[model samples]
Target: MSSTNERMFTRRDFFKFSGAFGAAAGLAVAVSACAPADTNSSAGQASTGADASALNEDGTITAAISYELGTNGYDPMVTSAALTVAANWHTLEGLTEIDAATGETYAALASSMPTANGTTAEVQLREGAKFHDGTDVTAEDVVFSFQRVLDPANNSLYASFIPFITDVTAKDDRTVEFTLAHEVGVFADRLAVVKIVPKAAVEADPDAFSANPVGTGPYRMTENGANKTIRFERFDDYTGPRPARAAKMEWQIIPDPSTRTNALQSKTVQAIDSVPYLSIDQLKATDTVESVQGFGLLFAMFNNEAGNPFADVRNRQAFLYAIDMGKVIQTGLSDQATPATSFLHEEHPNYKRAANVYSFDQARARELFAETGLTKMRLLCTDHDWVRKCTPLIQESLVAAGIEVEFTEKKSADVYNTIDGVPGAYDVVIAPGDPSVFGTDPDLLMRWWYAADTWTDTRMHWKGTAEYEQLQTILAEGLEATDSATQEQKWGEAFDLISEAVPLYPLFHRKTPTAWDGTTLVDFKPISVTGLTFVGVGSTK
Candidate 1:
């Protein structure tokens, strides 16, 4: 297929770009967050599961997490680390919260769900709520939290999630009024994006507060991610609906899939996330393991800067068509994922099939490559274990299609560190991301990659292009439309536009596997997100 002026990855003088995984890829970085006493942290002093003797104390939970804290701290405003974000869910509260297991939004800090429609709505603070530090939760504190995230100067990554909110003002000591740009039916649900913080604590010492946040949630962070292990204690003063059932909790930051699996098998931790695909059946023998389908995905992102070979939409589309997604899903992922039919997985509530879907067509791929004069390309891939599985096969397909491949793998964090980001930074990048950990809304998911300056400007370099403008307009219409059918229609249009653009897109949606001891932990429902959640979970040991 040829189009008028179809820019191809051909000219000898032309440069190529790299692809990075979208924000919805859920794998954690290989490294853990900076810690003051990491080596000394002991998540378990318990015997192995085979010992037949119990040593863990009652009301205590231990877990091994595949995600590490990396350079980020515990602050909900900016930290994207999978482990830190999940931990925050235990130690923080918003006016409303989306449950980790059910995806249902419920009032947490607010007395009840407020009328989040219209340009204006008021929220009443939950009575007798107290912060981890014993300070009473008040309306002013809620306003402060929202303002800090909305403050452009703060550069909070979450600001993009609620662009409709114009301002937040405390109507009185216990009531706060939200001023929106327009009516938003999901307004209360989106508020969960910004976890309420204590103004006094945050202002007292911002750095200290980020490392160890104080909130009105069920748990208090005790370890601040020092020593590769994070510890939490149940906050007795918390007056929220989901009170912590465990008195103490310890999380071992184990990024290596094998080590994380062993930690659970050896009874070192009660639960673990990111169970390697091959190890799932083995783990099921000794523990309860479930692979939950979610919005997490491994994606290919292109460099859309002028002169970059992938600057042309045709090349981007051709790259997607080159891969055999059926084989990739079956062999590479152990049939653990669904090939992308839309930007979202098939399970997503707002999922709409895109205008264009890339199925493996080697003959067509070759035709596009030959049309564009593209013979050789460099690919940069993140070295996550599972990613290692898929990239090689993706490389194999391109090579079979008569393209020379210069493929390089690096730790996810290191890729961004060394990349100078010239016009074509290694032609393309394949990495993992999962922003659905924030919320599952179509607007929230699309904003994360399309409208966000970080992805569109710095990564894809498509911010000022005509296609970007079109996608943004469609997204705005969807978010502002209160009617369900109209919003879905607009969102479907946005998905179709992005589907054709393919600036950055998911290859497949992942089925995240999590394992926990059914006999030891009570009410421990596995989450489809990157890490583990222990809220309302207890231990019988």
Candidate 2:
């Protein structure tokens, strides 16, 4: 397959999970009724501040983030948490990279991208690229990195992203070659998903390495901010195209929406991500808040194991139809999210409305419930700051449809622990996910929930069924198709099958609102994913 260099926007975004994250999308441009001129982030320039002292002269850019550090650590090979992946963006490098702000992929560890169409492709590492630990980057490190992710015993979540690659071999000290299982057009940009790490450091102490990995990127992580704050310092010897524009970076892990907004307002931090929809208008008075729409979604996943009430597709459809998605979006999300028409948001370049859309139909919902005799069902939900806003309304809608909802809300990790591998723990789960944080391709997005081993075999228990086999077949065809049109058609068929299957699906694709003081932090743009990035940003303070 002839691959293009685009990853997330083209192919670079990654972290495929329905977990606690604040990340992307359509310009849900937060233009409150009384908006200020400076708040228009679409103006395409940094928003300047009047308080010169608030700017940092020490070249430090501080931010308040609403996402909690998930149970996982910062191993790019295994870490799927939004917070850690965002940190890895600055502290790690792929042979190619996705520009956080622009969604464009460019070579980072690789000096330049070579042209190749067949199974074999060679990558040349940039000369003199050094890890934060002062070790030189080598082709061997790149090979080791890919090998670990491909190792089945490791069971890296990213292994699903590049099933096409059979092996990665170092041709020389600085040159590596990729041997593909098959031809893939996205081979180049998909390289961003596996961030290169120092093999010596990782193999020496995998635990310590996960705690604070050493990489070839512009910044090195100092504090992981388990309960307090995360910190980074510039790698002065960095010789990459986008060096750290600041001397230091600090991210206050404030998961409370109100507290995060207050921190940004009080100037305790120069920027904040996952800005509450209700707080956007007021904060816009002082900061630049842009709600970019990405593929981030609030999903409804059903336990489809045998004997589970939701094992019946009709019950799953009934539950989805019962939820008044319109009110949920308008009131719970403050109209900051779009009701999902497909797995992908409508704005997604590859989106096609699923054949069956569960628009609010209380009567139809009741009809299906009566047919399936699903009177009482347990609902599992996560307490992620933003997800909290909608779960109550979801419960009410289900109750309104005459089904008893035994609602249980926990932190993202707890919710997954309750359901992962344990069948029938809950009939349905309402949570957040943004696989687009991984990339924008339909294959990557669909495989995240449908084809990935953990989600298919454990969480939803949809594997081994005829429908599951059919969906998998369609997905494989989509990935195998050489032409774009045929691939998209196959993907559309997968969406149609998923719509009817209803094992797990999206309720809506959300907008990510991020607040940053442009005057204090120069050239910093909000991404449509869950974490905050300050890659090319410089602080006036």
lDDT of each: 0.76, 0.77
Please list the Cα RMSD from the true structure of every candidate, rounded to 1 decimal place: 11.3, 7.6
* Candidate 1 segments exceeding 4 Å error: 1-58, 419-424
Clashes of 1: 18
Best by TM-score: 2
Question: lDDT at 506 for candidate 1?
Answer: 93
lDDT of 2: 0.77
Writing each residue's lDDT as its tens digit, candidate 2 over 135-203 gives 888999999999999999998878888888898889899999988877777877688888999999888
TM-score of candidate 2 on Cα atoms, chains taken together: 0.90
Deviation of model 1 at 439, angstroms: 1.4
